[model samples]
Target chain A: MSAFKKIIPLFDRVLIQRVKAAERTASGIYIPEKAQETLNEGLVVAVGPGAFVDGKLQPVALKNGERVLLPPYGGSAVKVGSEEYLLFRDSEILAKLE
Target chain B: MSAFKKIIPLFDRVLIQRVKAAERTASGIYIPEKAQETLNEGLVVAVGPGAFVDGKLQPVALKNGERVLLPPYGGSAVKVGSEEYLLFRDSEILAKLE
Candidate 1:
């Protein structure tokens, strides 16, 4: 992979790599792709300075390389470096993975 | 309009009415619809209880009748009655309008 990628998400948006969904459920049932939610786990590659607050910039709470669980409905799909990444605002992140 | 709508967002999801965009700028220049960001103002019609936490439910911070500002991305398109509503999780809301 190249050392640098030009795509930097602007304004509180975080760039993430979507984790693949498991093919089968714990009960050993094969679930169809459409039945499952697209919301997935990911590694934060880059994050913008937190959303504007009272005309001031707040520091982003999430750091690069942290795993995150995103909400299903946010973010736009973009292809980068042979992988797919979703760009969404910091507020769009549903939870952080331990 | 019917007194009760069959749609209710589940598990921290919310239902909102989308605000219309202004076609012309204050400068009197004609702006294309696609040129502007989709994030717009809205009113909270219904909101979920809250997202899961250690297998327990948390109370949603937003109320049913408050005005909100949703992030540019997030929420799915759905039509109910004579208006349009976006269905998305609480995290998808970028800000609460004053």
Candidate 2:
């Protein structure tokens, strides 16, 4: 949390940590690393103040800890220590997961 | 203009046509296709009504016909007949060229 706090996304940008895919099957069968599917899901770690429009600052709809569906590609990747994070504009995010 | 008018971007999205790079050198040398550099500049064709925030509709800062700097990547490509266009969120646009 402290590491994430250091990142302040600017102008409708969001910081997200990708949610890892499951390593095993329901029956407990191990899935090899090569066979793992890369997921486009992530958790919102930080959100920027909304972009300004017509001289007013609009607030972004996203909140911290929300699960989100990411686009196939496009976010800027940032490495903090050994963890990787992504920065995307609120509009670039495909959808908010329930 | 009529062809471009057919595209109406939604929700803070913008439609842009990339500016083409020069095909000849200052000395009147014809630059081959392979040597041509793709430009990251574009003309704004259309803009969405802006995304809704806190129950109010905000307007994007960009205007049609404005020359803008585009990100190197990230935009949905659309083909209108033989002409190519790109759709990107307003925030995805890097800057406005004077």
Candidate 3:
């Protein structure tokens, strides 16, 4: 988490760290790592200032530490040390989890 | 041209009519219709008011009658009588052709 502080997304771009899939099934059976489905859930790490609108800056709607839904595709993938992160335009975020 | 007056693009969308490909080469050799390449040029027929930014409506950058370069794909297809037109967001226009 501390390593992410160095990355400040620019222009409405949001940096997100994907949440790992569950390792167990609802029936309490252990699921193999290869069988786990990729989750679309993510935690927002940082957001850009905003995209320009008619030459004016409009602030991004997302905030740090917010849990959000991510699209299945798009977004630039980044690897920090051994952990991975993704960068996407604020508009690409599907929705806020809560 | 008169038929186009009835259709107006909305929300920064621009209606464009594609220009036909050339039937002859510079050397005056006749080119078969099947051999001609699809042109990416288009004439803007109408432009939407603008997309909302921070709740404010921003005017579109393009104007009617402007010739522009278009992307190889995207844009909605529309048929009016015997003519075909395409609708694209203002941002999708590649560049203005003087």
Model 3 sits at an interface RMSD, in angstroms, of 14.4
- Which candidate do you rate higher for lDDT, 1 or 2? 2
> How far in Å is the alpha carbon of A56 misplaced in model 1?
1.4
Which residues of candidate 2, in runs, are more than 4 Å off? A1-50, A53-98, B1-5
Superposed by TM-score, candidate 2 places the C-alpha of residue B83 at a distance from the truth, in angstroms, of 0.3
True contacts kept of 1: 0.00
**Each candidate: RMSD:** 14.6, 10.9, 12.6
> What does candidate 3's lDDT look like per residue over B10-94, in tens digits?
9989999998877898799999999987776788998998988877887776788877656668999998888899999976665
Lowest summed-lDDT stretch of 10 residues in model 1 chain B? B1-10
Output DockQ, candidate 3. 0.03
Report how far residue A25 has shifted in candidate 3, in Å.
61
lDDT of 2 by residue, A1-98 (tens): 11222665657888899999889988999999889899999999888777776657779779999999999988877655478788888999999999
C-alpha TM-score for every candidate: 0.42, 0.51, 0.50
lDDT of 1 by residue, A1-98 (tens): 46465677788788888867656776989989887644356778888866666666655556788776566476888876788788977666744544
Off by over 4 Å in 1: A1-6, A23-39, B1-98
